[model samples]
Target: MKEELGRTIQQLRKVQCYTQEQMADAVGVSVAAVSKWENGVSCPDVTMLPVLARYLDTDVNTLLSFHKKLSEAEAASLISELSDIFFDSGFEAAYAFLLEKIREYPGSDMLVLNGAMALSGAMALSSTLVMDGDQKAAERYEEEIERLYKKASESDDPAICSQARFMLASRYMGREDYDGAEALIDMLPDEQAYDKRQMQANLCLARNQLAAAGEIEERKLMLAANSLNMVFVTLIEIAVREGRLEDAQYLAEAADSTARALDMWEYTAQLPWFELYTHRKDRDNCLKTLGSMLASVTDGWNYTSSPLYRHMRKKEGEERFGPRMRESLLSAVEHDERYAFLRDSEEWNRIISAGGGTDRGAGQDET
Candidate 1:
């Protein structure tokens, strides 16, 4: 019986273009077990038989037939459908469905791992969705995220483990549990973690913001310079809000020098930096920057649909800079019809009616 079963397993595996190691990995079993099953030295237990059948895309009865009881084409179709569901809808939804299928065909590691992956994916998505600052939602997301992380960690697949760790770190960040976030991040492989140049720059900005918030004044000029050069526009907004005009100016200057050094003088970074200059009562610089930006608006550099740009143009017009600003405002109206919708929006009307002050009261910070 073992010899016959091994023969059957070998034939089915070959038909599916799977190596023993590949099949073993997919089914969460050992290559030795697959080898034993194929060599007729041993047959899998009754529990593992259903798992093997599912993994090889055949029924137990057909597998026991010793000869072809099912067509290879039919088995291929079933395998293709399973692969599609697993890849498309992701692991959780597919796993939920597979769990029901497992009940009908018990003790199948093929179903188990597939279901586990689906469950993991569902948990990851849930964590991401609930990542907003809701305590109850965060708790729920964290629970599921931890469960998936544990499961993935115990699995042989290093990729899945890495992904789970990344998601866990993200969840920790969402909950403002920076210690937990750091722990998880430190555990990740450098290649698997958020260590891209842009990401590192953003991280520096976040750390600087945290330092500023905490009033930890050690005067880290390098930190400020790196963050401002990478994420100057955001710093400019913060500066404007906090009435830190000098800091904003310094940051903008640093960003401008970096942009020029990188030969990106007409980059998107310049637009908001120009707005920052406008806030600093530098109308000449703002006008000059806007003029340069307009000239650089080729197919590659164009971003006419930006609402912020429209708002900036409106502000520039109100400042009575010149006809050039007026023409830009007119061009914005002509290009993006979405600006028309924005003008008619209730929020816009309320803002206009309140003279740009919120109903919550002026000088009331909602941070």
Candidate 2:
């Protein structure tokens, strides 16, 4: 607690453009005392704490570095806002916004961890752009992200520490710092005694929160169904690659059947068949599959109708591309060189003119 308090004091002081000597004068303490407090070598006298906190423009709780702890939903909402700022305004704007929030909630471990994540993503995106000063901006963002990750890694919350360490390991790996990556990876647990979702549900049940437990189980079921669908798709891909077209067809059917049985998204059910038909250059089937894929996106499908996922609710900030996504899919098919064979086909034209495949397309007929 003393160490955390010291770090917070130093951070706030620096942020307010205060030197140790200046802080000492403002708080009526010696420069040496301020240095000790910042270094965690000693703490401020009890009476002087409020004075020091006032000087740093923060309250005692913030100064002690336990002012706030964001709930998961709050953190997710904040991250979503940051992402919108990064994409719409610019990386600089997003970075400034996150910095302001960090100053406001210096003791929020989730905020710090999520801010680092947002910065890391924006920095990576900027690095990929061939623009002036992008390299320098990426470097600056990287330094701040690393600092925040290191700070969060020291948190008492195991979840925050683990996420911070994993992100740090990823950063190291990106820079070819193999030894650093390996060390961080070694700190992570290889297995857990119980899955966190199930454990949480059990806890809810113990507390007689039956509805909450049911919701958790419903979410778990939805995730399991999604994962199973992906496994089937992956096996189909591998089968096709190994010249096992027959096996691939069988797997694709299985994947489609599984999606229907689980009440999965319409697009997901058609995905495997699209991949398979494209690989075999089956133009007729490809056009049909593409139409079904586009129809799903345009028609607005959700899991609410699914009996298996009835208790699960959509999370705030979940990605929804809307009509623009359908347009992009249609545009890709119309212009991409890989789809040249489908471009002039009568079926392709019909599908496009009808504004992407209708409900009569592939998955609809199959199910």
Find the candidate with the highest TM-score and give its number: 2
Candidate 1, 156-267: lDDT as tens digits: 4566566667766776797799998999789787654553444544565687754333222212322343455557787787998799877877776677767545434253
Which runs in model 1 stand beyond 4 Å of their true positions? 1-43, 51-164, 188-245, 256-367
- Residue range 293-351, candidate 2, lDDT tens digits: 88888777678777777777776655444464575577666655667888888888788
Q: What TM value does model 1 have?
A: 0.31
Candidate 1 lDDT for residue 240: 83
Q: What are the Cα lDDT values of the candidates?
A: 0.52, 0.78
* Cα TM-score per model: 0.31, 0.62
